[model samples]
Target: MPEHRSATTPRPAAPGAAAPAAGRGGAPGRLLVRVRERIQETAEAVSLVLDAELPYAPGQFLTVRIPGGGARCYSLASSPHTGEPMRITVKRVPGGLGSGWVCDAVAPGDVLEVLPPAGAFTPGPGGLDRDLLLVAGGSGITPVLSLAKSALAAGRGRVALLYANRDPDSVIFREELRELAGEHPGRFTVLHWLESLQGLPTAAGLGAPLAPYAGREAWLCGPGPLMDAAGTALRAAGAEAGRIHRERYFSLGADVFAQPAAPEPPAEAGVEAGAEPAAEAEVELDGRTYRLPWRRGTPLLDVLLAAGAPAPYSCREGACSACCCRVLEGGVTMARNEVLDDADLADGYVLACQALPLTDRVRIGYA
Candidate 1:
């Protein structure tokens, strides 16, 4: 039997809020334990069970730390009312470091350090008493699944889910979702979008069924382009801005491969001796400019971290694209990059963690 763990500890009361005096016991640590790790579709996705109680709102996400690497944010696949043992279904992308590791190497009894839930994906009171429409692609179903389950448990019966996948085999949580829809009858409807399946619905084919729920709150998630397309269709059907929410999931080290090599220093700027500063160095981020003091062979990320810039980053090894930023001005050189593409590199994108300033000034976005 697996033991249960709390997904989140009780939060301290607000300043003017209720009881509990000082010297009372502090809160316990909130962590999720790996109770079960099973392969769902070989090399594609996996189903994981955490021995923790995650009382998460419908659209929040948890940042799971990959030991010796970095964190990967994932939406809770199970609803809060499901009781102890939270669940998350992860889909593996080709050569994706974190997703691949979770799907291949992670095992039972392994503990995953998880940060508290965060994000504005959760819907408010307005979402209740109205038809709920969800549009998801591939693994983007995670958060939507949670929302659907939570809505059902709360007795908000008017809900519909449109899930798109490459094929039937790649459809995640297929049985569970089917069961949920079956239990709810006419109150719940799930449409499958299979690119490879015969007679599957396409973007245009979905217009009719989704049109009726155009006034409903719509939640969209998945690949960037796919989400954009769905949003366009939903809006055209009359869904309002406030009623639609979109969330994007980026791989940890996807941007490193997008940077070009740094230009060589001028002849006068030779390699420094001892602790002397380099002759030419500068870094720019998010429309703001910062001079990189010529530190002798110092890692660029170290300098940025020391400067107190809230640079987006995960897996400093250039494997995750979390640190990727656009080079609005100058260029940079990369130490290593397994992410990114030729077009991205040509478009002036660079991974801050793996880049060193080769010019005097460079502009980028901390965003």
Candidate 2:
């Protein structure tokens, strides 16, 4: 099977794997972690080394509660394949509540409340056997760096990175990337595009430099414009659509840590006032099957949370795929979905936080 499928496809739980924690008010359980060290990556970006150890893939992210209120998701910069401590890089955004606190106020030894690692932007099982083409802009390099290092250190594949930034002063992990290139001259390659020297990237311009590696599996993350340009360039250079993956960069508008609002009544879903009572839903999660009442208008996440089922989720707004699950026996419709492409939908994936049942007897699995 193709490697990216693992990110969207559910698989059976391994023996001795930890079960999901029961939901707390429809939010994933939180962990309090101490900041072991803080590295100044750039003028506006800071990398926090967390003292906590948890199972996480290289490209996953942690949803952190802001010091005051609200929350933000920061991608992991450390690779689990390597022996590095868990770390997350935060780039300060103007007037950003979460980034501002972490960059300016957060100090070593400070305790932080964060959800466990969650995200679908990861290279799945056996993902590092083939050559990889990575593109990053600004802080998007965080996860890209993790994947690059993991491929170089643990896998047998060639890795190429095309990183763009405002200028030399703005490049994060410059020294480390240099060291990697030096260590693996044949297997690793780096290309830096400083906007200070080259104007904003264009598809036609980037196509030439990326043409050679266009056939490789490509992963892109950065600002929307940069990603759009890179994607266009790759496609023009003969990259297959299925071989390219993208990570959208966004800030959550709602606090995922907040208690989920009560679901609307069945009438809201066009169910008759005197319709039959809610039906039972069979949900498979963490190797356990749960029988819960499926409310007509209620989202699956809310029902599971109310029942104390251990369902996985982050960004209840459907902006992230942490709550993604497959519908095996029935159908569901999403109220709103910002993630999950057409291929993902065709493969039976749905965002549990936004899903409303379309069938009374629905069966779902988290693999």
Candidate 3:
């Protein structure tokens, strides 16, 4: 029998790989994990392995807190079943505090605090028996790869990936993906769409390649446009909305695609005259109600968390809906949003990390 360690180990494994029967998931107050190692994946990406053993579903992400530098979320690229160090691949964002630190500063033995795994894209919605179509762009390959290994390993389902990158040298996990394909033979397939050779890859461009798996269930992660394009293409090819899942690395405010924020116009006189004062908030978590201080520039999630509320939040940047809550009364506005769609918006769901109250008093509930 393989020796089992006393603590959580995150190594590479398929999603279907077995894990310890019981383990503690690093909840909010317990986010500390020691960095075991850092493996360079590409010119811009590095994978960090943690010493702690925390069980998390595949496709979920951990909120990484850098002591005084605040927190950011990154999806776990390796499966929890590996019984090795838990691994999260970080792509260096040119000016990002979290990504920059992960890629440049973190090393063997370094420790970082990370919130528990949170996300809803894991397997079982359609079960592991159905065919799986994996789509990704740029660094978005992180979670898709995890999902791929999971689908393939879980039920021996056929898996195909359509990965888009800038050039041949830009792909993260290139060799590993190739090896997986080689190992799986007819069951796994991968195709690369390089911008240098074929221009930017879009959903419409995927029509021909995706035709074979038109009815297959798909999961996608990438920049906004890439995700939109892929989603459109998948829909055009007859994939049902129910069978497709999507997530973004950055919200529109953060610009996952690097599209610059438009220049702001000069402020006119009396700009504040009609501008309303900050909104007071009444937040409910687990049947407890607390009055929230609406700080001028603080995220609602931070406010709630600091107030001792078990406000679930990962990636306060508004991309992931880990902090999503039901709006009970009054109104709110998001600085940027990438998670909830029009229907969700109409239904009054808002990401607390991204939302700012618009009315004098806003009420939000976790349920």
User: Per-residue lDDT of 1-367 in model 3, one digit per residue for the tens?
Assistant: 0000000111111221212222233433335667878899888889987786665656667666654445566777886534445678888877777788778888997767655556555564445567888888877887777777766676667998999899998899999899889888999999899989988877678788877886887877777687788778888988887667776444323322121111222122224566445567787765578886565444577667566565655555666676667788998888877667776678787887777767767888764
Q: What TM-score does model 2 achieve against the real structure?
A: 0.88
Candidate 2, 1-367: lDDT as tens digits = 0001113222222211223322222333566778999999989999999987766766777777875668788888999788999999988888777788888998998888777677776666677778999998999898889889989988899999999999999999999999999999999999999999998888987988899999998888787788889989999988988788888755577776775533442232225578655756798876679987777667988888767665666678877777778889888899998877787788898998899888778899875
Ranking by lDDT: 2, 3, 1
Off by over 4 Å in 1: 1-32, 36-43, 126-128, 198-205, 251-367
Best by TM-score: 2
Q: How many clashing residue pairs appear in each of the predictions shown?
A: 13, 0, 7
Model 1: per-residue lDDT, tens digit, 170-282?
A: 78878888999899998889988887964444446667767877888888877766667676677789887656677654444422212211222222234445434343435
Give Cα distance to truth, residue 15, candidate 3, Å.
15
For candidate 3, the TM-score is 0.67
RMSD of each: 11.6, 4.9, 10.3
Per-prediction TM-score: 0.59, 0.88, 0.67
> Clashing pairs in model 3?
8-53, 9-84, 10-84, 10-85, 10-86, 15-150, 31-114
Q: In model 2, which residue pairs have backbone atoms overlapping below 3 Å?
A: none
> Which candidate should be chosen as best, given lDDT against the real structure?
2
Give the lDDT of residue 201 in candidate 2. 84
Q: After superposition, how far is residue 172 of candidate 3 from its true place, in Å?
A: 1.0
